[model samples]
Target: MNNKTTISSFFWQIIKPYKWWYLVMIPGPFVTAAFVFGYNYAIKLLLDVLTQDKILHYGDFVYPVGIFLGSHFMVDIFFRISNYAEWKSQPQVRKDIMCKVYDYVMGHSYNFFQNNLSGSIISKIKSINDGYYYLFESIKHNLTAKFLISLLCAICLLCINSKIFIMVGLFTVGLVIVSMTLYRKLGVMQGEISNDYHGVIGLIADNITNIANVSLFASKKAESQSIINHQENISTPLRNKWFKLNFITEIIVTMIYSLFGISVLLYSIYLKNSGQITIGDIAFTMSMTFLFQDNIFGLFIEVKKFVNTWSDFKTSFSIMQIPQEKIDKTDATELKVSGGEVIFENINFGYENNNKVFTNLNLKIKAGQKIGIVGSSGAGKSTLVALLLKHFKADNGNMIIDNQSIYDVTSDSLRSQISLIPQDIVLFHRSVGENIGYAKKEANQAEIENAAKMASIHDFIETLPEKYNTLVGERGVKLSGGQRQRIAIARAILKNAPILILDEATSALDSETEQQIQKSISDMLETNKATVIAIAHRLSTIKHLDRIVVMENGAIAEDGMFDELLAKENSKFKALWDRQVNGMVL
Candidate 1:
C-alpha cells in the first residue's frame, strides 16, 4: 500500500478509541467561522453608520457593537477551550500508541532484540512522540482556524464591489499557485533533510551510550569527524530548502501587498470623481482588503505547516505499524514443565540467509537431567537453547517438551517454563530490591532476601548502607561485573522455572567465587528439583553435570558423561578438556 493509505489507516485505528474527543473537537472550526462572520459584519455596520454623518455615533453602534464584541469574546473562549481539549486528548492518544509499542517490543523474541539496538529503538520512540503530538495539534488548531478564516474573508470580499472582489480572488489564486510550486519543488527535499537530521541525533544517542567503548578505543577524533560529516550533510540541504521557500514567499507577499495598495488607491480616486462612494467606503474597503489578504497569507502558512508535519507524522506512524512477534490468545493453555524433558529432533535453522547454524540437531534429556553444552564461539550452542525457547522458529523438525510440540504452546506459556541466564548481565537503573523483584513483582521482602542469599549475594548486599535498597546505575553500571552477574542469577533462581539454561552464567566470577556460586546453584535447584541445561567455556564449571555435549563447527561432535569423554582420547570433548588442562598453570 501507498504511504498515505498506510498512515491514514494507522491514524484512524488510534483515533477510533478516542471518539469522544473527536466529537467535541470536530465543531471547533464552525465556531471559528461564526466569529469571523460576526466580527467582519460588525466592521461593515460601523462603516455604514459613519457614512450617514461626518462623525461616528456611539448610540447607533451600542447594541451592534455589544453583539460584535460579545461574539468575539465567546468565540475566543470556545477556541481556547477546544484547543485545550484537543491538547489534553493528545496524551491519551500518545499513551495508547506507546502502550501498544511497548507491548509489541516486549513480546518480540530474543533474536528481535539482537537485531535492534536498545538505544536506537528508544530514540525512534522519542522522535515519534514529538512529531506526532505536533502533527495532531497542528491539524486540530492551525488547519481548522485557517480554513474558517479564509472562507469568511472570501465571502466578505465578494460582498463588496464585484470587480474589486475578482481582483482579490485572483490575488489569492496566484498566491496558492506559488505555494503549490514551493511545496512541489522544495517540500520533499526538506523532508529528506529533516530525516537526516533526526538520524544524526540517533547516531549521537548510540555514541553517548557507548562512550566507554569509544574512549577505550581512543577514537574520539574519528567519532567527532563522523558526527561532523552527518551534521554537514543535514545542514547543507536545510539551508537550500529554507532559501528556496523564503525567496518564493517573499515574492508572493510583496506582489500581493503592492497590488492591493494600487487597487485601493485607484478605486478611491475613481469613487471621488463619480460621487458613487465616499471616503468612509474607501477606508472600509481598504481595511477589508488588508484583512482579507492577511487571512489569505495565513492560509498559505498553515498549508505549509501541514505539509511539513504530515510528512513527519507519516514516517512515525509507519514505524509504529511495524509488525511485532505474535502473541497468543488469553485462553491458550500453559505447558506442563514438571518433567523438565526437552527434546530437539533433527532441528535445523539459519538467520538472514546465512549458512545453517543447526543442521539435523537431535537431543533428548530425561527429567531432572543436568546437561552441559560446550562449544566454540560460533558453534550454535546458544542457538540450540534459543530454539528450545522458540526465540527464532526452526526451519526443520520439532522441539518438544513433555511430548507436546513447542510451537503448539503460546509464547508466554512456553517461556514461563524456562529461565535463561546469559553471560552478560543487564539490570535496570533501580534499587537492587527492585531489579531482583522484577522477575516477580509481587515478591515479598523475605522472598527477595532468600533469593539473594541463595545466590550468595546477600552478604555483599547487606554491606551497603541501604542494602537491597541501594540504587544501581543505568544497566547496573554502579555494580561490579561479578555483582551484576549474581543479581541476574538471583533473578533466574527466584523465577524457579523447571528448565534452567545457563549460557556461561558464572563466566564473570573468579575461580573461587565461581565454585561457590556453582555449588549454591546445585543446592538450590536440588532442593527445588529443577533441571539445568548449561553452556560453559570453562569445562571445570560443568564437571559435575550429568552429561557433557561438545559442539564444533555448528554440530555436536561428542556427547557422554564427562569422565567417559575424558577417558576417550579421540573424542573432541577430550581434546577441549586437554587444552583447558594444559592452559592452566599448575
Candidate 2:
C-alpha cells in the first residue's frame, strides 16, 4: 500500500474504538479558529471607531473590548476541552495499539523468533507505539488546528483584497512544495538511520547475552571496537545528511514566510494611503496575514513529523505483515491424547527443499513404550522431536498421536499433551518455585516441591535461605548447568503430559548425578505410565530404555532392544556402542 493509505488505515484502526472521545475533539479546532476570526474583526471595529472623526464615547470603547475579551474567553475554554479530550484518549489508544502489536508478535511461529534478533523486535514494537501516539497527537493539536486557522485567515484576508489573498495562497503553496520535497528525502535518510540504530542495539544485546563466551575468549576489546565501527559506519553519514537537508529546508521556509509577511504589510499600507481602504481594513488584513503565516509555518513542522512517524509506522507494519509460519486448519480439533501411542508414517521432511532429512521414514511406538533414538549430529534426531511437537510441518506424510493426525489438531492442544526437557535449559528470571510451576500455572506449593524432589534438585533448593522463592537470574545464569537441567526436569514432571521427550536431558550432570536423575525420571515414567522418547549422545544414558532405534543418514538403520542391537556386530547401533566404549577405554 502507499504510505498515505497505510498511515490513514493504521490511525483508523486505533481510533475506531474510541470514536466518542474523538467526536468530542472534532469541534475544538473549528471553534478556536472561529474565535480567532471574530477577535480580529473586533480589533478592526475598535480601530474604525478610534479613527472616526466623531467624538468617541466610553460605550464605543467598552463594545469592542468586550467583544475581544469574549472571543478570547471562548478560545481558551474550547482549547482546554480539546486538550482534555486528547489527554483522555491518547493513553487508551496507546495501550490498545501496543497490546494488539504485542499479541500479533507473540503469535508468530517459532521459526520467526529463531531468525530475528530479540532486541530488534523489541525496538520495533516500541517505535510503533511511540510513533503512532505522537503522530496522532500532532495531527490533533498541530495539523488540524493550524489548517483550520489558516483557512479562516485566508477567508478574512480575501474579504479585504483578492490580490493579497492570491499572494498569501501562492506563498503557502510554495512553502508546502519545498517542505514535501525535503521531507521525502529526510524520510529515506531516517529509515536508514533507524536500521543502523537497530543493528547497534542488536549487537549490544548479542554481546551482553554471550558475555561468558566473550570473557572466556578475552575479546571484550574486539567487541567494543566492532560496536564503535558499526556506529561510525552507519550513523555518522546519515546524521550529516539529515542535518544538511533539514537546515536548508528551515532556512528556505523562514525566508519565504518572512518575505510574505513584509509584502502583506507593505501592500496594506499602500491600499490605506490610496484611499481604497480604511485604516481598520489595513489592521484586519495585517493581523490575519501574520496569523496565517504562523499557522502555515507550523503546518510545515507537523508535516515533517508526519513523514518521520510514517517511516517508523512502516517498519512496525512490516513485522505485523509477516505470514505466520504455522496456522491451524479450519477443521482442526483439540487433541485428546490417551495412552500416547505415536506413529510417524511415511514421513518426508527437510529444513530446505531439495535436501531431505527424513525420506519416507516410518516409526511406531506402542502405548507407554520407552524408546531411545541414537544418531550422530545431523541424523534428524531433534528434527523428529520437532516434527512431533509440530514446530514444523512435514513435507509429506503424517505424525499421529493416539491415532489422531497431529496436523488435524490445534497446535496449542497438541503441544499441551507433551512435555520436553531440552539439553540446554533456560529458565525465566523468576523465583525457583515460579519457574518450576510454569509447567502448570495453577500448580500449588506441594506439587512444585514434589516435582523438584522427583528431579533430585529439592535439597539444593532448600539449602538457600529463600528456598523455593530464591530468584534465578536471567536464563538461570546464577545456577550451574546441572541445577538448570534439574529445574527443567522438574518443570516437565510437573506438566505431567501423556508424552515425554528427553532431548539429552541428563547431558549436563556428572555421572553420579546423571544416574540419580535417571532413576527419578524412570520412576516418574513408570508411575505416570507416560510414553517416553529419549534422544541422547551418551549411549549409556538411554541403553536401559526398553527399545533402541539407530538412525543413519535420513532413515532408520536399526531398531531393537539394547542387547539385541549390540549383538549385531555389523549394525550401526553396535558400531556407535563400540566407539563410545573404546573412547572411554582410551
lDDT of each: 0.76, 0.86
Q: Residue by residue across 211-304, what tens digits does model 2's lDDT show?
A: 8899999999999999878778767878898899999989998999899889888888888888988889888888899999988898888888
Model 1, position 237: C-alpha lDDT score: 60
Residue 17 in candidate 2 has what lDDT? Answer: 84
Residue 209 displacement (Å), model 1: 2.3
Give the local distance difference test score of model 1.
0.76
List model 1 lDDT by residue over 118-171, tens digit each. 655665566566777777677677777777776776676566567677777787
Q: What lDDT, from 0 to 1, does candidate 2 have?
A: 0.86
TM-score (C-alpha) between model 2 and the true structure: 0.94
Prediction-by-prediction clash tally: 0, 0
